[model samples]
Target: MLHYLLTLAIFFAFFAVEAWGLNLQFGLTGILDFTYITFVAIGAYFAGVAAMTPSTNGGMGGSYIFGWQLPFPLSPVIGGIAAAMLGVVVGIIGLRRLRSDYLAIVTVSVGQIVWMVIGNATPLFNGWDGIVGVPQPYNSVMNLSTNNYEWPFLGISVIVAAIIFWLVRSLTESPYGRILRAIREDENVAAALGKNVFRYRMSAFVIGAFIAGISGALQIEYIGAWNPSGWTTLETFIVWAAMLVGGRGNNRGMLLGAFLVPVLFTEATRWITIPAHPLLMEAIRGMAIGLLMVLAVRFRPQGVIPERKRVFPLTTIPGLKEDVANGHTAQG
Candidate 1:
């Protein structure tokens, strides 16, 4: 039971990281970037394959590619870099042409292609098996001797989450974040004003992807394995749901939504007693998520904790765009 509890904590930390990444892209930038999970999968696969021992990584007996047995601590770095590289490549193509909805479709297709390739490619990713036995971060440092390594896991998870939050918070509040908002509001206007809209958008996209990759890498470490099912397109929707319910443009709301919606709902499943049809719980949960999203959009669009708008008192600096907390409001 303690193990389960510890695992649940790790799960909370995991979604929190994922939500942070998503909040940067969709919440702040309004890019939709539905293919977000592909970057995560990239990180997980790279981290997994890199960490796997030669004996179990690939091949029937002992065959591994660049088998370094690198410590788990380094996996996130490797995974994040891999994910960001992949994100850059994708951003070049997709970010070139598309708006909110259309952009989502292209991103979704890209995510599916990644999934299909990873799921089908046997040699590259060991097929469906996915390299297992990936080590947890700092198991050696903690020097604990039991499966109850949950404490250290939780500690590391918190540390990583804090660092990421600090980094993202700094970024979002900086001048770069202002550019993202401008682009989100009116790309044409931004472009008209001699703003390198595409360049800034690409940078935002790549940074968001890197954050998502870090989350994915950390998740693989926590779970001790990285598999094809590690990242799914549907999973992105779940995080989106949390962001919507919590507040699209608010950090507090993002964190609240990440914990309250997905993790809480998953925990709530234990208490739900449905007689006849055991799988009903799953369906019911899905419906609940769908209903929440609809209600959020219709009734509570601002979310539980609405975003606070920044009020500028007639002090318009060069390149400073007007913005309401919610929608894009940049002037050409």
Candidate 2:
């Protein structure tokens, strides 16, 4: 049971990073970005292809482009850049002015196409068989076996998560993050205010994709496999649910969302009165997530941990902004 709980913790923690990335893109930027998981898939595929051995397992493909077999840390970085580059390429075409719903349709369609291409093209991505027995980080040079000393690799993941969380927190607090929020609120107003809305949007979108790649890299390394079957578009909805439940636009809320939704759900399953059935359990999980999203958006749109508002001092406020900025503040 302890091991099971530990596994749950690690799994949710990996997705917490995904939630953070998606929050930055969708929650903070007001962009749908339903292709979020595609970037994760890219990272997973890139990392898997690059790190995997040229071996065959269960007839899965491991014939990746980078035959050099780089270090684990370096390989994920490459995957992340690849995701970002792909994001840029897609965004240039997809982000052209279109209605919100139209944009979602286009991007989501692109996602499906990308998945199909990877599934059908064996030379490019080894087709549907996917990659297996991918190498883990630092396993070779560290002289540690995957069979033993799992703690060391686990510890490495925890450290990487910490670093990523800290970086995201810092970025959200920086001016760049504020610009993103500005664009989200009113792109027209932000542009009128001299903010390059499109550029800023592209920046957030690409960076979010990069971070997603990191999450994918970590997950593939931990599991030692990557398959097209695992990273469906529904995966993006899961991250969205986490972001909304935890509190959109709040970094800590993303982590809390990750834990409360998946980690706690696994724990709560112990009280299940019905016998376990795979299809039924999956349905229940989906319904639960959908209900959670509805409840969160309808009842508590701000989330469990609301974004902290910055209070500006009086005196220098704009047009009655003094009172508004000060303690007795109302509207301008």
lDDT against the true structure, each candidate: 0.76, 0.78
Task: Point out the worst 10-residue segment of candidate 1 by lDDT.
Answer: 57-66
Give a tens-digit lDDT track for model 1, residues 282-307: 67887888888898889999899887
Q: Which stretches of candidate 2 lie over 4 Å from their true place?
A: 55-63, 141-148, 266-276, 312-332
lDDT of model number 2:
0.78
Which residue segments of model 1 deviate by more than 4 Å?
55-66, 140-147, 267-278, 311-332
For residues 194-275, write the lDDT of model 2, one tens digit per residue: 9877787787888889989988888888888777888886677778888898999999999998888756763346456456
Which prediction has the highest lDDT against the true structure?
A: 2
Top candidate by TM-score: 2
